[model samples]
Target chain A: MTRVRVDLNISLDGFATTADQTPDNPFGQDWGRLTTAYVGTRTFRERVLHDTSGAGTTGVDDEYAQRYFEAVGAEIMGAGMFGLHEHGDDPEWKGWWEDEPPFRVPVFILTHTPRPSIEMKGGTVFHFVEASPEEALARAVAVADGGDVRIGGGPSTVREFLRAGLVDDLHVAITPILLGQGIRLWDDLRGLEAGYDVTTEAAPSGITHITFRRESRG
Target chain B: MTRVRVDLNISLDGFATTADQTPDNPFGQDWGRLTTAYVGTRTFRERVLHDTSGAGTTGVDDEYAQRYFEAVGAEIMGAGMFGLHEHGDDPEWKGWWEDEPPFRVPVFILTHTPRPSIEMKGGTVFHFVEASPEEALARAVAVADGGDVRIGGGPSTVREFLRAGLVDDLHVAITPILLGQGIRLWDDLRGLEAGYDVTTEAAPSGITHITFRRESRG
Candidate 1:
């Protein structure tokens, strides 16, 4: 079985983004520490950002970044993270990460509408799949081979997997910012009975890098 | 006019609660720096938990907490925050809060099912209203008099308010933790064209307390 992993940045008060989310402030400054964590390490930054210069040398954050990037094979995300036309009828904008996206592998997006697969300059290919989480994971896992399957999300997509007990590994870079009013990641899931073992926990800079493995399912 | 506010604790990666979200890890962690924020200052701690000591101190967190307890004449929350149900149909669980909840005001819970209002010890009355956000906010605001209406949510409730532009002010206390694979607050709200101004930012602790005022719709 292919291990499924999740990695994302979060604020201290547990907000992924502000309530009135706009292009200007996406994750809000609450996730500043995570952003700092990303930029702080030269090797991790270079690998993810396509500017490969440093490697092997170890730092606190660099280890986390390396582990996260290495564990995942392909990425699966929700369309909301890709664009924004969630409520209203008008569908105009794409995503904040325009043109050249960050991911090097093929990225699958979960949505109701259908859009053409956009292939960016790098190995980033955005495939809009209107299937369920199982199908998406199947495709991602197949592509990942022996590597891990990663769920890239704003929150709902993650919950979809967690509710089904499909996730295996988890990595969260917790920043120390709070958006007193915005979207929250944990509101929809309240009664879930999943147990996670904290395999790794390190406070690099200010953000804590914690990794968890899902325990036995009843 | 009466002011309304929301004071929530979140992890650095923006998870208000952990992924597994059980009664044991209610707020998560035995006592990390984040959990300590809830009972942090001796004076404020006494007032909230014991209802004494923290009468008139005004640190950033104190000011923030005061904003919630003082200005918030009434509040609106979700079923997830209210309680943990065994079955979606089960009616035993009321909420994770103790006999006397933290908020000593009128709290209107937005639920799909109908239930009678449960008035607690302090001045807290939980009115389970099976209405829309607009309806809930209207009722809450009506009860608020001049006080601002605080949207105490898990995430969906806040998103509804943001989509409706009914919220006036938002204060987020971004913590430094993350449940990367749970529900996300900003999942379906990626493309809304809303704007806000960062009015105040104070880092009393490592948790930078920030306030974002939504742009006027006029």
Candidate 2:
């Protein structure tokens, strides 16, 4: 069974994304500021930025950033993450990523209006699905083969999976910045820590990485 | 120049106290569970519990717990923290603490109905005052005698001081327990991190200690 995992960058006030997000400023004023710790990592530079210059920090933040891409086969993300909401009806909007997206596996994009699957270069394929979290997870799990299914998020998508108790492990990098108003990750998910064994590690980049792994009932 | 400091034990969801708080259950259902890290520390056991046996954990948690009383002279707390709400209209109500409270200086209780000052044993004195955060801080600072003024909290009072930006340093211990509903300490205080330099340290006891020190502007 492929375990479901989620990794999110959240503010100290629990906001995963800012309220001022728009087409022009998708992540709002604090987007770049909040993700600086991750984006400055060597793994993120190579994987996400597709930079071959061999730049970026290599420490605790990089260690956690490297783990984010490890042991994950397929991914399930919301429409917002795919930039479908912002660039409505724009066929040109493949995704925020370049020609070769980082997943290197089948990626399921959950949207209300489903579109035909788009297979990109470098072993990355986008499958648009209009299904519930359970259905979506099954589809992603099937595509995942033997590896884990990662729940790529914009906060709401992760909240849905978490509320359904589908997530087996969660990694939250709490940035020191405060977005104040945005979509909260912890709303309505009270007593969430009871089912999980939690551990926290503070990185030198001023970000606190909190990991929660589900405890086996047996 | 007496710096105002605050120390609170909060849940992962940012709750300091639960809704079911009462005289019988001071900290509600999660009191003992949430405060286990602090109460189990050698500093807390010695200062607050008045135990001189030198028992309890001696590590990161204890180091942070010890700072709760270091370099501080006076304390300012809400009426709810003093148990005035539960035991109302009783002049005989001295306080929940015994004769020698942990605080060895003047402690101001912010209440609507002010009462006569009661000087306790062991250099501790309780004074009831109907004052705002600034007014109360002024009084506490004066009595602090150049030491810091500690904002002892029940959440709402701390919220007021935080909103006013009177706190110079804040230490919050994020416990592993999750209390779903309660008075949140981070509510209405958005963009609070912008004014301070924040750092996080995780302890072996599974509690993450977050510190925020106000940045000095020359």
Candidate 3:
């Protein structure tokens, strides 16, 4: 079965990113710190940063980070995550990721104003579409070709998919920092645990990795 | 060097207790499930329930629950915790605890309508007082006799102390269940980790124990 998964790095207070995000400051001041655990992982350095220096922490955090890219295919992301609001009608904004984006699959960007698909150097293909979470997921799933569909988020997007009951597995790495104000991942996500079996593992890097896997509906 | 500490069992969404809290449903529908991790501990059975059966889990959860009563002399709680709203105008009404309450120290209840102190069985004494978090901490510290002063909460009370930057150490046990809606412990207390050295430990019972030890001000 193709699983729908989401992997996000959040603060201890449940904030995934700060509020004052802009084109230049995509994640605000706390972004680096919030994702310090993942960014310092060997998997992140190799897969995301394309760095094979063999640097970065290798343990519980790395294990979890490595799992982030283990399975299947397509990704569904929010407009804010695509850096659209910042470059506003630039007609040239590819994305925050470098020419060779990390995601080596068909990426669906959910936005109000759809744009032409942008295929980067790598296997990543950004296909902008204005559709509901279910529709987007369906499209992503078809593109995934039986592989898992990843719900990439900036908080609001993830919350929508979760509320729609489309997410199958969710992994949240809670860093020890506290971002006073930002987009909260848990807002409107009441009784979220009722549908999933939740488990937590505390890593040596002071990050608590929480995974929620969907139980059988029956 | 007396420390001010807080120990609370919160849901995955940060709710310490549910919203529809009543005298009959003191902790709301999910109370039992949320606190099962703590209540099932041998320390809770012995100390709170006064059970000497010695029949309870004795692992990480038990170890942390056992520390709930260590090195704390006085306790400060809210009126809701004292059950004043339930049995209003009934002077005979004491707390919901048994004739012998679990707290074996001077217990201060912060309420707008202060009443005469009530001495319960065992070493627990309920003293009603109307004061700010700092003032209440001062009174509790005085009675603590150089011991630690514990901030016993129903969420709002703990938020106040945390906002005042008076807590020396805070321990929050994140239960697997989600209350959906209730009194949130992290509301308005943003940037809370700035003052504390935070750490986390995931227990076998699926509870994540998060601790914040205040960093030296100087």
Candidate 4:
């Protein structure tokens, strides 16, 4: 039974993304501020950035950061996260990530422009498809191969899966900052704590980690 | 010198109020769930509700609840929170509170229709005025007399004070619930965490209390 999980770093105002995006700095200034705790984690420094200097935070943030990469057979993300819109529909765009991407599993990209599966170094394989949230999850779960199917986000993509009741565990790191604008993560998720056992833990670095796990996980 | 402070209970999605308001139950259904950790505090039970049973929580929620009433020489609230919209200007509505209101301070109500001061049984005094956030804060600070002037809110009023840079301390209890709709407290207040030293503490009851105190106090 592969559980569907989500992890996002949002502002106190519930904004998952910042409004200060420019061509020079695509992720925006506040994006760095919003993810200060996560990026400072040893796991993030080693895994995502491929910087194995062993120089990063190793507390609560790193604990969740470790859980982020642990036991996720497959991943799903939006076109924006995959930078398909930024790079255009060119076949040469292998994604914003490095040659050896982070997720070493079947990574499903939700997009309108269908593309051939791009197999990168390591285990990450990007599969582009135009499908509904259910269809996307089915493909991801099928390829998950018994590990948890993680819902990698750009906010809206994660919202779609959450609204469809496909998420088993939702862990949101609420960083103590106000982005005031941009995409909000909790816009349409009213009464989302209905069936999930919600728990929260505040890290010393001023980020609160709130987890909502399904009471009856299959 | 009187410092301007604010205390609010908001959902994880940043909604300060819910949309389930009806004639019978004015506060809406999710309001209770949103403020469960708050109203369950010992200080809230005693100070707000006047429940002398001494039967309430005495944890992190209670600690903050106690701080909510400490040294509050005066308060400024919106007409909505004052129930002016619900109850017409018959001059008979003594603010929907009991004869002895919880706020034993000069309560400034921002309204279009000004009314003479109404002195309640306790030290609570309702003074209706048609002034901007600055003007209202000025009046409240004038009466504060060395104690802190609290910006009591219905979301918008607090945002006004926050935007005007009149707040010295802002403590928001982010309850782990999503209303999905209603008044957002963090709108238009971009980069609100700028100069303030932000901190967070997650309670066992699943409420994360985030505080932002101004680094430089006048």
Best by lDDT: 4
lDDT of 3 by residue, B1-218 (tens): 78999999998778888676577875666888888889999999998888898888899999898788898899999998888878647988888897999998999999998889989898889999999998998899889987888999978999998888898899999986656688888877767888578889999899999999975342
lDDT of 2 by residue, A88-165 (tens): 598767898879899999999999988788888888999999999999999988878788899999799999999998
lDDT of each: 0.63, 0.87, 0.87, 0.90
Residues A1-218, model 1: lDDT tens digits: 56887776664444555454357976544344336766667765576555666633357767777777775668898877776455324444445656666666788888887677777766777787889998988888778756677898867788788777788776666554444555555554433323665533435355555556775331
TM per candidate, chain B: 0.79, 0.94, 0.95, 0.96
Lowest lDDT 10-residue stretch of candidate 3 chain B:
B20-29
- Candidate 1 Cα errors over 4 Å, as ranges: A1-218, B2-5, B20-27, B30-33, B42-44, B51-58, B84-94, B191-193, B199-204, B215-218
The native-contact fraction of candidate 4 is: 0.99
Please report how far candidate 1 places residue A128 from its true position, in Å. 31
Give the alpha carbon lDDT tens digit for every residue of A66-100 in model 3.
88998769999999888987874898899989899
Off by over 4 Å in 3: A20-26, A215-218, B20-26, B215-218
Clashing pairs in 4: none
- Against the native complex, each candidate's DockQ, computed on alpha carbons, is 0.05, 0.69, 0.70, 0.92
Give per-model TM-scores. 0.48, 0.94, 0.95, 0.97
Instruction: Write the residue-wise lDDT of candidate 1 on B38-86 in tens digits.
Output: 4565445665567565444456666666555666678888877776333
DockQ score of candidate 4?
A: 0.92
Docking class of predicted structure 1 = incorrect
Model 2 bad stretches (over 4 Å): A22-26, A215-218, B20-26, B215-218
DockQ comparison, 2 vs 4, better candidate: 4
